[model samples]
Target: PALRSIVNPDDARFLNPPDMPKAIQAFCRETRQPAPRTEGELVRCAYESLALKYREVLGWLEELTGNCIEVIHIVGGGSQSAILNQFTADACQRPVVAGPVEATAMGNLLVQVRASGELATLAEMREVIRKSSKVAVFKPGPAAAWEDAATRFAGLRRGN
Candidate 1:
């Protein structure tokens, strides 16, 4: 809810005016839509907006690399948010693997282990972590709904 209040549909920081530094404040006000009144609505708006943004980024990456990104891995504390994880899957129409909630800490420890010569290769380190950690997976849902939402979000973003 806190994020929702600050960054409507999602944070406007990514929007490329470069000069405009606000979040979603100006966009919400300009859209003539009432600001989210309830906590649930606020959270929904925030998560949905974030998911849409993720979809856009994924598209850009795929376009740049000329390779399909089949999966999304959400690491660290953010991975623990089941709601957001599921939203990402739905919005991006891809599978999301969320795990190692304390990923940064584990990564640091892994670095030490590697330096100590315990793990010789990156693959070996990944295998060890894969065996030890518990992860949650979210699969994409119906395409129609997510696609429609994406279209609507794109329109809103374009000031339509």
Candidate 2:
């Protein structure tokens, strides 16, 4: 079934949109997939798709930067999920360091501090965050099958 919650069912952004999780549920219903009522399923779909997109985008970034960047820092509420974090590490085939869950809040506060002449650049802000926040590191699991999932997800997108 076609996904129902958006003007374009092809756009995966409708799934677990940042603003409203309800809209995401509706998006699932549109596709005849089970509405992910539990936090785990909801986050699972969002994180899995996000990891795929991150890998895809990272490839584009690599092309643009002409460098193979292999580390990612995931900070925020979404980063709290060990399952999702490991999944991202696996999907991207890179080590991911996650934590400082209050990133958004910290960023906002940092901006305020900088604007008040208490800081200089984003680097300084990040230094402060490094001091203030706890971090957790994640390494890609032994799931070589994640590579297959990435291919399967791509196939799903292409309808092959």
Candidate 3:
């Protein structure tokens, strides 16, 4: 969380574009800041960038669907990262539900159980999963800072 205060997602130095070498060099030059040298810095940068990107994409999805996304459900191995989950919640201003780390295996088992006629519908299967799995919920934090960061992130996307 301390890193979130210092790391600006709008700063292109945090972004890992497809052409990484060229992009990092250009971003560092443009921002007049040294590139991330330590492992922790690099990891935090990546997490912040990813969280901002998620917020951006969620906006696009909401526009396309004409529906508000209340909560983000993150499964699989990625759900295990409390830091990333909290970052996502903060950046997106939405609750993040992360759990069922062994999602693939659980999904396969659920499908088999469903095929056996024990579960009558998809909702029933979902209920079973929800009841059986342990989940962590991260609610969004204070929005003022994140809102400012989001504005900068949007400007960055627009080539400002």
Candidate 4:
């Protein structure tokens, strides 16, 4: 909610800007909010900004595939962030599944298992992962606000 209140949406700087501190300052100035003074606050803004950027990439993938992506899967250490997962679902207006916190280690192990003939195919490996790992699901809320934000984000990416 705090993120929603401060988001300019139209500002390209929010799209993984070269300098986050500057972007935060600019965003605060534009939205008439005091600049974040604490690392936690800055981190929150950074997470929100990253989620919005993911939304943008999802759009590009959808366009290229000519198919709407139904769910987003986030693996690795970052997937542990429930806040970022929820933000991603909200920003993209889609379902987000985050888990396999140690994805890299899991994948490496899975590959070794496969090489040993324990797994016959990638599908089998996926099934093993699905059964072994726990995932958090985030369903999007209302689309109106996120849609508006996405539009602004797109415009920013296009340099409009």
lDDT tens readout by residue for model 2, 1-160 = 1111112224656655765467667655755556767666666666676677777778889999999987888889978988778877887888999988988888888999999999988899889988988988888876666676567556556644
TM-score of 1: 0.82
Off by over 4 Å in 4: 4-23, 26-34, 37-41, 158-160
Global CA lDDT computed for model 4: 0.78
Can you write out model 1's per-residue Cα lDDT over 1-160, one digit (the tens) per residue?
3223223343345456453323344555666644665557656767777888899899999999999999999999889999999989988999999998888988999999999999999999899889989999999987777787677667776767
Model 3, 1-160: lDDT tens digits are 3333223445545466776544544554464445655567667656776788788899999999999999999999999999999989998999999988988998899899889988889899899888999999999997777677677666556655
Which 10 consecutive positions of candidate 1 have the poorest summed lDDT? 1-10
Task: Give the better candidate number (2 or 4) by TM-score.
Answer: 4
Better of 1 and 2 by lDDT: 1
Itemize residue pairs with steric clashes in candidate 3.
Answer: none
Could you tell me every candidate's TM-score relative to the true structure?
A: 0.82, 0.68, 0.79, 0.77
Supply the global lDDT for candidate 1: 0.76
Q: After superposition, how far is residue 26 of candidate 2 from its true place, in Å?
A: 13
Question: Alpha-carbon error at 91 in model 3, in Å?
Answer: 0.7
Residues 26-99, candidate 4: write the lDDT tens digits: 76666555677677777776677677888878988999999999999999988999988998999888899998
lDDT of each: 0.76, 0.71, 0.76, 0.78
TM-score of 2: 0.68
Top model by lDDT, which number? 4
